[model samples]
Target: MSGQDPVSSPARTDSWSSKIDTSVAHPARRYDYWLGGKDNFAADRESGDAVAAAFPTVRTSAIENRRFLRRAVAYLAREAGLRQFLDVGTGIPTADNTHQVAQAIAPQSRIVYVDNDPIVLMHARALLTSTPEGATAYLDADLRDPGRILGDPQLARTIDLSRPVGLMLVAILHFVKDADDPYGAVSRLVSAMPSGSYLTITHATNDHMPPEILAAVGDADAQIPFQFRSREEFGRFLDGMDLVPPGIVSVAEWRAENEAGPRPSAAETAVYGAVARIP
Candidate 1:
C-alpha cells in the first residue's frame, strides 16, 4: 500500500472515536456478533437475533459467506500470485480473515481493509494481522467514499496500485442502495486498478427466499436504509469486466470447495457472489 498524500489507517488518528454510535444497530457490529465476536452491543445482538429468527439460515449464510472470502483469497494469493488486496466493506474481523487466508498462502500478500464502522475499526487494530513478509492496514471510510479509499495514505503505504490486486467486496454491496450509485462506486475504484486486477463481490438478493422471508429481510434492511438488488442489478457491478467461470452464482456455488447441499434457489439463499477480472 502507498499513501497518495500521507494517507494512513483512518484509525491512525482517533478515527474510531469519530464514528462510533452505541445507541443503534450498525451492520458491522451486528455481523461481528453473528460471527461470535465480542465487539458488539446489546442493540446489535438483538437486531442480529431478530434477523436470524426471520431467516433461520442467517448464521449459516454468514459463515458460508466468510468461507467464500477465504477460498477467494487463497485462490488469488496462491494460484494467481496476487500479492495485494483491497477489501472494501470488510466487516468485523473473525476467524480466517482476508489477510490471514492470503498471507497463509503467500507470506508476502499485503492487504488494506476498508470499513466505515467504528467498532470494526477498533477490532481491526488487533484482528488485521500480517505475516513477517506481508503487511495489513485498515481504512476507516465508507463504501460511498471510494475516493478516500483510493487516496488513503495508509492504503498507499502498503499497496502498489500498478499491480494486480484482488478487490474483495463480499456481502457488502447490499448495504449500498441504488441511489448511492453503487455501480459508479465500484467503477471509480476498479478504474484505479490495473488491467489484470480482479473484482470479487457478494451481494444479498431476494430471489431465493419466499415472499415472507423476503418481506422480513426487506423490513430489516429498511431499518438499515439499504437496498438489496436483483441478480440483474448485481451483474451491473461487473459491467465492463469479464466474469470468470460460474458467472454470478450463489456464494455457496462460486468455485466452492465442498458441496453444501444442492445449491439453494437464489431467493432461498439471498446472496449472489462473483469473481471478475478488470479487462
Candidate 2:
C-alpha cells in the first residue's frame, strides 16, 4: 500500500511484535522454518522438525508448493490476463512471491497479500518490494474474518473489487479446522471476486498416503493445528467454479510441463492444487 494507511501490514507489525508468543508454534513461522528461512524461532524449528521426521519429503513438498504457485501466477497473468491478485496466508516473503511473479509477466498487475502473523508482515515490508508499475500491499488479518478483509478501505484502494482478481489460498487452509468454518470463509472470499476471476489453491491432502505414513502424519498433526483433507473433502472449497486444465492434481504436477526438470510424485508431494475460473 501507499504508506498512507495506518492499518497497513508494514506499520502494524512493530507494535504487534510485542504480543507475539514465540513459545507456541505458529503455522507461518513453522512453514518458514521448513522452507529454510532464518526468521523463524526455536519453537517453529522444533515443530517443523517433528513434521519432517514423520514425513521426510515435507521440504520437497513445500518447495513444490511454491513452484505450483509460480506456475499458477504465470498462467493467471500471462494467459488469463488477470491484473489483480489477493494472496491470503502469504508466508515470509521469498523468491518469486505473488507480486514479483505476476509483475514480471504483467508490469501493471496489482497485488494485496494477507497474513495474520506480524513476523511475516515485518519481513514482507522489507523483502516484498513492489514494482513501480504495479501496486503491492500487505494486510495483517486473519482468514477467518473474510468480511473484515474484504471491507478494508486499504484493500479497496489497492485493488478494484469490480475487476477480475486471482484469489490465492496456497498451503494455508490445512490450519483452518472444520470447527472454524473454512468453507464459509472461502465462500465469502469467492463471492467478492467478479466473474472471470480465478480461485487458485494448493492444499495438503492425505488421499495418496499409505497407512504407515498416515500414522506418522497423525503423530505430527497432534503437535500442530493441521487437518489434512481427502480429495473428496477438499472439493468442498471448489464452489462449482470451472476448473482449469489438469484439474485437481498434485501440486508438483499442476502444469508442470512448463518446467524443465522432473516432478515429484503425487504421493511424495501429498498436496493437491488447482486453478479455477470463477463462472
Candidate 3:
C-alpha cells in the first residue's frame, strides 16, 4: 500500500457492513477527508464540502483538533512521563498520530487505538506502526461502549492500568449527543482508569459561532446534526479531573506553540480543547 491510497484489506473486501450505506455521510470518513486522508467515499467528500461551505471554520477546527492531539500526547509522554495511551474514537491514521507523537518523545510509549469504522480500522492496522521498543493495536469499538474498551482483554496486553495512561477523545464526544449522556460516558471511562492518568478532549461548540453559520450547518446535514454546546456545558465533562494550566479553552488557545492571539471572530471559532489529570 502506497502513501496516498486507502489501505487495502486482505480477503475482507466485503468486511464493511452493507448497511454502512456509503451513499450517506459519516462523521469519521468526513473527518478523515478533512485531515487529508484517503479513506472517505465521494458522498463523504460532498457532505464535508457542504459543511465547510456553510461553516467556513470546519476545516480549521479539524486541523486545530489534530494539533491539540499532538500537543497533548507530547505533554503526556514528556512532562507527565506517561508510557501508555488509550485513544478512543481514533480517526483515520494521519500525520503525528498518538503513537507517533508519543513514541517520538518516548520510544517505549505503548498505545492502543479504538474505533468502530471499518475503513479507519483497516488504515489503522496499515499505518499505526509502532516503534521497535513500543507496541500498538487497533480495536473495532465505539466511544459509547467504554466498558467494552476498558474491559477488553486485548487492552491489557499493551497497557498497564496501574500505570498512568493518556485517554484522548479528540473531536469525538460532540458526535455523542446529550441523550447518550456524554458526561456519564466520560466519567465511566475516567473512573475505570487509575489515578495520575490524563484525560484530553477537544469538542465543537456554538458558544463561539454566529447564528447564521449554525443555521447553515443545520441545513447542510440533517442526518447528523452538528450539535454545538456552550462553554459551561463543555467544561462539565472535566468536572472531577484536575485541569492542567490554561484550563478549558479554545483549541487554538490550549498550549499553542504560538502566542495566544486574539480570539477568533464568533463565526471562526467553534472548537474547544483541554487536558486534565485524574487525581
**lDDT to native, each model:** 0.80, 0.86, 0.81
Please give the lDDT score for candidate 3: 0.81
Better of 2 and 3 by TM-score: 2
Alpha carbon lDDT of residue 75, candidate 3? Answer: 85
Query: Distance from true position, residue 174, model 1, in Å?
Result: 0.8
Model 1 scores a TM of: 0.90
**Lowest-lDDT window of 10 residues in candidate 1?**
1-10
Question: Which lDDT tens digits does candidate 1 get at residues 1-279?
Answer: 222212235545376556677778888888878778888888888888888878877776776678778878877887778999999988877889898888888888889888877666566655456677888888778888899999888888789998999999998888877788888899899999898999999988776677888788666655576677789989999998998788888787778847566655454566888888898
Q: Any runs in candidate 3 off by more than 4 Å, and if so which?
A: 1-9, 12-14, 17-20, 259-267
What's the lDDT for residue 56 in model 2?
90
User: Clashing pairs in model 3?
Assistant: none
Model 3, span 1-279: residue lDDT tens = 122222234444246644367887888889988888887899999999999999877887787778778888988899999999999988878889999899899988888888887767556555457788888877777888889988887688779999888999988888888888888889899998899999999888888666887788888877674567788998898997889988888887778856355645434657878899989
Higher lDDT: candidate 2 or 3?
2
Ranking by lDDT: 2, 3, 1
Instruction: Provide the TM-score for each candidate, comma-separated.
Output: 0.90, 0.94, 0.91
Q: Candidate 1: which stretches are off by over 4 Å?
A: 1-19, 259-268
RMSD of 1: 3.2
Which regions in candidate 2 have their CA more than 4 angstroms from the true location? 2-11
